[model samples]
Target: MEPDRDSFTSLEPGGDNAIAVTLGILGDEWNLWILRHAVEGAKRYGDWMREGAISNSVLSARLGALTDKGLFDRVQYAHRPDRYEYVLTRRGADIWTVLLTMWAWEQTWAPPATPPLPRMRHIGCGEFFSPATTCGECGAGVEAHDVVAELGPSGAWPRSVPASITRRRSAGAKQPSQVIPHTMELIGDRWSAAILGALFLGARRFGEFSERTSAPPTMVADRLARFVRLGAIDTEPNPDRPDWVSYRLTPKGVAFFPVVVFMITWGQRWFRAPEGPALIFTHRGTGHEFRPRLACDRCGEELTASAVSIEPVAD
Candidate 1:
């Protein structure tokens, strides 16, 4: 499926919503990497081939999809065979902040199996900096504990983001939980977020996680180790085999529920489907959809961009 006509052209028929559509367009396993490389100056077909290990067919498809999504505009640099280079448009450039947040998260909480590449420097500050998300209304820190539920239209919603509700069966409602800056490293994108999402949905073993996400076994194992280190999950012995191990989300890992739910909310609004959402979250046994909110813990207002601001990093 493609993004709703609002953002990009229809790539396929039937979508759950905008989140599904956008993910369909931009959330492919290799798509974001393509953007990251483009930002760093990789353009030629061969350049992608050499560095990204992408096959021609998949690369071609993703390139077309991204072009349709308005991120990349192609420029014909060659004439004989009409070869072209893909360049970033303003839309493409805009996603960099999302990427930067992910990079900051990886640096802080989820280091790769190999040593990380060179660090990012803020040109203005002339120093390596870790990015943070803060309340626009107040300079106070944004944590899980600092937010509340301001649900529905009385609650302000972004022009784009739709509301998310979880566990329809429960009489109780859910509030947007605490999310510190470092937590961005964990839930901002697919791999890390997908792991948490799958675990929350009840996949426990290594094989189960591998099956649930696009991540390969190596990435899964690496991230599981990182999560263990971060206290998001704990290892439990398999009863059938003493040597076999399974992973479960720690309480801290469980706290990431709102982030995944919000992704669904945001995706649904932007990536609309003809029929309905591709997937929905509900409580086990009761089978109720959950409704979630992003509220301010301080003034208890519905948090919006106009109401939030980033705080200066403490020296």
Candidate 2:
């Protein structure tokens, strides 16, 4: 059955939330890698081919989808057998911080061995630094414990991201050449992503998770087990009910909050709704709406793609 186009177009989480819609656009490994390469200066068709071992057909499909999704603007750079280069649109360039945050998370937890992930030099501070997450309003550092999240105007409605819309790796597809980070594993799966979001929202019991995410019991059980295996969450016997269990985020899981914050920031900024945002975060310290900003860990200045340089990582 075809997924509902109208439902998918909206930015709400209830069958039509922005986060799920954005995830449908970016949740695939190849899609993420393509965005990474784009940030690293890949534009022309040949540029991406040389940057990664992606096949022509796959790359073509990805580029087309990204372009259709408003991340890239394809422009003709030549004629005759007309040739074009994909340029990042404003919406596309904004993915820099999201990718940077993911990179930082990988470095700390899933360190790759092939070649070290590139060093980031913040030209603003003239120092090599990791990206830091901070509240844009007050400039104070932000963490899961430092903020409280509440359902926004649209958030109160129960919505389930259509499972069919999310892109998934085929069983026979080539495994991602880059080291798959925990962030990828968690976010790439719709159910897993929704369940983790539920945990952050204080859904400790199984029923709450299932209800909030609108995931089937089997799917929820499978992802919850996977989270435990990844050490992102722990399962504990419920104190009041011996028959049930509670899921709690481990330190590693809580550490993933920055990625979630960035994802929410990017998604909400790009995807709008007539009602309101799906989630509103209030910084515990400032008592102000939490808008996430990526800053240089060394000098505390905001990090921008132009203001920072990434040393290319070897494939």
Best by TM-score: 2
**Model 1, runs deviating above 4 Å:** 1-15, 25-27, 137-139, 148-231, 234-315
lDDT of 1 by residue, 1-315 (tens): 433333633323431234434444443336656776777677878877775456787678778877776678788998988999998766565554445454444445444423243355444434445544344344433443344322232111122121221111235432112123335345434466557656765788988888766577987888788788888789999988889898987766655544444545545444445544544543333334444444443344444322333222332
Give the count of colliding residue pairs in each prediction.
34, 6
| Total colliding residue pairs, candidate 2 | 6
Backbone steric clashes in candidate 1, count: 34
User: In model 2, what are the clashing residue pairs, if there are any?
Assistant: 11-17, 11-18, 12-16, 12-17, 13-17, 14-159
Name the best candidate (by lDDT).
Answer: 2
- Whole-model lDDT per candidate: 0.53, 0.78
The list of candidate 2 runs beyond 4 A from truth reads 1-15, 111-115, 156-168, 313-315
